[model samples]
Target: MPAPTHLLIPYSFRRKGILLGALLGILLTACQPRHEQAAEAATPPVGHYEGSLNAAGQPEVRATLDIRHPSPGHYEAEFTAPGTLSFVADTIVFSNNQLRLIRPARPGQTLALTLEGDFWRGALTLDSTRATTILVKRGVPTPSTYRAEEVPQATGSAWLFTPADTGTPGAALALLPDAETAPTAAIWADALAREGLIVLLLPPTDSATAAAETPRLLAAVRLLRGTAGADTANVGVWATGARAAAVAQLLTTAEAPRVAFLMAHNMAVGPASNAVLRELRRRKLAVLGLYGGTTASQRATALRNALGGRRGGTVLTFRTAGPDLLRPDGGAFGPGLPGAVVEWLQGK
Candidate 1:
């Protein structure tokens, strides 16, 4: 078989053409902007950040930023400057390597940060004042302030949070939610304990009826009353979700303990019924209702209106916190929430 000479180009020429093509491709890639090929704004910088906030006339303030994407299509960010500034951003957005954290409660207040290498550089603007800031990713684990021990009940186990401090607790509160199972339960319990209050964290129940929960509630109250350092006379209940309704129902029954107060956290609706409201009013129990997140104001307003003219019925938004009452990282309580509860209970 004879090969056709016209179809066979010179080997040297073919090699040169291949080399030239690869060189052109390399040049094109190298000339393109680096950002155009990078990942989308580095996945929104989700984690903890700590650094400094600088004001023109004041000393630098240490600050921290916690950013989290708890679920799909939702974001949480909390910024704290110790004694200076603290807020949970009502909305968050990241685009083109820029981050914007905003809270609608404070008009003209916004945190604008730009991603730089391994840190965020920007300014926090409040009204007309803008403070320059820088934040670097850091490990800041949520602190635990109390020791927990499991108390076995006939139905389930509960957790008792005794403050590490030697000082006697001023009051006792039975957290009647899924405190034993919820992810942030320890943080809530410890936060209360940090304020010199003994927290009895009740376990989740399987029964749907308040009748079944009544005995458990009474037992928790009794345990708190018997705790060595707790002020038995000042025992109260802190509740959320359906358990809140159960607590309300229990309060109206003859078997109910004489609870001093009821601290309701982030409830979307008002009391379970008019009967519950009447029971609360008749008992003259101090009600400290804290609402947070997007619907906080509306819920607070509704609760306030529901208790119109009733003394000891205090319902308000909880310092612009998120619904869960925990920071984005689930490490600590939201800004001033535990402190607010302590302050109100102290006054009571």
Candidate 2:
């Protein structure tokens, strides 16, 4: 006898259910790439990339790209080539494994690169020129660019940077914290050296007490005076972070003499007493005060007012520079900052 019609009906329903499941599987299979693409779009591949660019008839140019995501859906980037190119882009677009570096000016596209295996390879489109570029993610060392020699001091060792072209280069003692803790400070010293300034980068102590640290700083200053390529007559002090106040104190010390100028970066003037300002003014110190961020203008103005219009007291506000007196990426100085610093030094 044939099977009951009710059983056959149930079997037919089971077959339909299997076909429905197959259709759902196909739909999910088709949507998998879309889901993955959405995920990729949400999380951009932002990083620091260092590489070289090749143009049709020009020398190969070394470049560095820094992409940062400070907030949700907000991105900032910096592209730097020591002698070739430099720009900071606040607007950039990343999609489908492609990155577009948008210029704030007309003809928007600056660099159009695609994510390849361990590299961002593409063309740099600037004006009428296009260059083939390949970048590998790497941490470019800060002090690697300049030649440094260790000069042992009573307190510690100082890295001496002498200019190759100038026998008597303008000297500045960098009062920085530990290099491991503050790498940007080391970069600042290297940047000054790159501009042909003789820099004696002194090792910082654990203590920030002016009275305790001034002696060591003064000893390093004296050592800078005796250094072969350093110009003792034009020696100055470069201070950043908490060391700025101590540097001001150092200048007031009896042992500290022949200190022609003082360059303070990102220093809070609130910690400095009025007496210190008065003394600095009495000495006719050539002071360059640089403050950064939103309150830069106000801080700079306050410092200027504290100086009471002392000669050679030039205070500038770099809206884009970080607390370290360098661009956010720490790859280079802010707009014309290095040149302005060098010009001021030459005048002194």
Candidate 3:
């Protein structure tokens, strides 16, 4: 056979090379923002610190905290950590080199804390939570010099929804709208229940946002669980996409409710996230994944191959290529198509 001119010519190869490079450049530029956003979300906005508290007097309350760098000499400040804090105005503030948290006071819960952070670590003793108490001591990195910049408000509709306990909820269903848009997946939730799984709709949010929102999300999950069947001992919890932080949380510690499945999309996790996932896998809980955004097709292939190799396994996915971000509030998140995640979970 005669050799093809394009194959024999060096210039042809160079043209292809240039085209490949151009495509790659465009792809990289397009992808950098999303990855950067993901990384950013993974970061807790620097100033607001978060930790759980067993005590909040008022059933409804908001919390906020502000930590700042003071005069570049010694870092000192004050802020309130309010419960049910608004995501719009109430932010985890850090400024003027001061530590301050301003949260709405709850009835019967006069608990508050005055925090101090320096180069080494921070000390947040309860100024009011329980007469006086000290919070967990964490090492703080070197403080940065103050730069006047407008702190952006937290965006998205992914609400915090933590359930009360490990029980079935009532008829009322808890729907978590994706930060980008509200998912109509509530319809699928009912279908999921038939398969011995209870779907916990979670909107997409990253670590920084999840830190404060996790509690509220958990609270809602707890609320919905109360509506489950009055006599089932097994309760399954489900979340998708970036909204998996609460599940990520429960896994980090031993406090997660009895779960049959932890359905997540893309399965993107970070250092803290990996810590949580490892813990869940340790507990023998199923970590199921559907079609997600990672282009390395081998990842899904590996997951399927790995599980398929087992004697018996549950799959939290479909033959689908990608997941969609269908928010209840009309906003969309990165990369996944929000199809029937609930159905996918219930093995439909």
TM-score of each: 0.55, 0.57, 0.36
Which 10-residue span in candidate 3 carries the lowest summed lDDT?
11-20
Report clash pairs, candidate 1: none
Off by over 4 Å in 1: 1-145, 154-156, 165-169, 178-181, 268-272, 309-312, 329-332
All candidates' lDDT scores?
Answer: 0.62, 0.59, 0.34
Which 10 consecutive positions of candidate 2 have the poorest summed lDDT? 12-21
On TM-score, the stronger of 1 and 3 is 1
What does the lDDT come to for candidate 3?
0.34
In candidate 1, how many Å is residue 286 off?
0.8
TM-score, prediction 3: 0.36
Candidate 2: RMSD over Cα atoms? 22.6
lDDT of 2 by residue, 157-275 (tens): 45555543455556666555543325445445555666777776667666665776565555556656765567777777877656777777767878565678888766667645456
User: How many clashing pairs per prediction, in order?
Assistant: 0, 0, 75
lDDT of 1 by residue, 246-310 (tens): 77777888988788888876544554555676668777878887776667788777666655543
lDDT of 1 at 275: 62
